[model samples]
Target: MDLRPARAHEAGLLTELALESKGYWDYDEAFLAACRDELTLIPADVERRRTTVAEEDGRVLGFTTLDGIPPEGALGMMFIAPGAIGRGIGRRLFEHTAAKARRLGFARLTIDADPNAEPFYRAMGAVRIGETPSGSIPGRVLPLMEYVLTPR
Candidate 1:
């Protein structure tokens, strides 16, 4: 797969990929509904943040977004198409995001990860720091993790 910056016009396609990837967990309709707004990605977002897509055979298989700068950078979004899961697509996108963050001078990267995605982040070298209230689900807590980029 090739990792490249997301194009302005591919926002809608990326958004669809995000929703479909999320749905892969088989959450109830109400849960998905609550998370809709947070999952939606628009053209403006593409222009505002550092976003990249994993493409192969002219098809986007996954994507990730990075927000903020040094000492405060965050993995804002990451999703892999349902059909592309378990083929190392997510890992490639994540490593790319981390490398980009380092190049941008970030000392670390933070992640507010979904419960189902905690393991992936952990395997990517993120350590649990705490929990934060979910932006979409009432009374839900999300894992807060950090991947330190600077050497000790």
Candidate 2:
């Protein structure tokens, strides 16, 4: 697979991939509908953040985005194509994102992770910090996590 910076024009495709990845968890339509706006990615977001895409044979398989600057950077988005799950693609994207955050002088990276994705983030060394109210759903909470970057 070829991992590289995401191009602006690819935002739509990446957004679709994210939704598909999220749908893999089998949430109901109402839940998915509520998340639509939050999952949407626009070109400006791509231009403003550090976004990376993993592709193979010209097909995008996964992607991740890092936003803000240290001492508090954020993992803004991360998604693996439904077919690409369980193949370590998410791990590769995460490691790349963490290293990039470190290089950018971030002391730590924060993630408001999906409950389904908490295990993956935990395995990647993110510690559960707390839960935050979800912006889209009333009374719903999302897991907040942090990954500390060792000084280089």
Candidate 3:
């Protein structure tokens, strides 16, 4: 697999991939529907953020986005295709993202992670600093994780 910048034309494809990945946690239809907007990747998002895709054989296995200015940033999104789950793709994506963040001079990268993905983030060396209200679900709270980027 290779990591590359996502093209604007891939917005829809990436959006579907994100929803499928999120659904891997077994969220019901209503919840998924509610999340659609927040998860949607517009062409501008693809062009503006450090959005990248992990592709093999021209197929995207996963994608992630890094957003904000140096010294502080957010892992805006991290999604793995449902079929690619548990294949260590998520690990690769996170490591690559962390490295990118460090290279970009970020001191810390925050993540608003799905509950089911919290353990994965923990494994990636992030600590849950707190919780934030979900942007999608009104009553839901998501784990807020932070990875302190060290100088390479």
lDDT of each: 0.91, 0.91, 0.94
Model 2 lDDT tens row, 29-94? 898888889888889888688889999999999999999967888999999999989999999999
For residues 1-152, write the lDDT of model 1, one tens digit per residue. 79999998999998889888989999888988888898888898996788999999999999999999676889999999999999999999998889888888889888999889999999999999999898898899999999888643
Worst 10 residues of 3 by lDDT: 43-52
Q: Which candidate comes out best when scored by lDDT?
A: 3
TM-score per candidate: 0.96, 0.96, 0.98
Clashes of 3: 0
In model 3, state the lDDT of residue 68.
96
User: What's model 2's TM-score?
Assistant: 0.96
Query: Candidate 1: where are CA atoms >4 Å away?
Result: none
Q: What ranges in model 2 sit over 4 Å off?
A: none
The candidate, 1 or 3, that scores higher on lDDT is 3
Model 2 lDDT, full chain set: 0.91
Look at candidate 2 and give me any clashing residue pairs. Answer: none
**lDDT per residue (tens digit) for residues 1-152 in model 3:** 89888999999999999999999999999999999999999999996888989999999999999999999999999999999999899999888988998998999999999999999999999999999999999889999999999987
The CA-based lDDT of model 3 is what? 0.94
Error of 1 at 100 (Å): 0.4
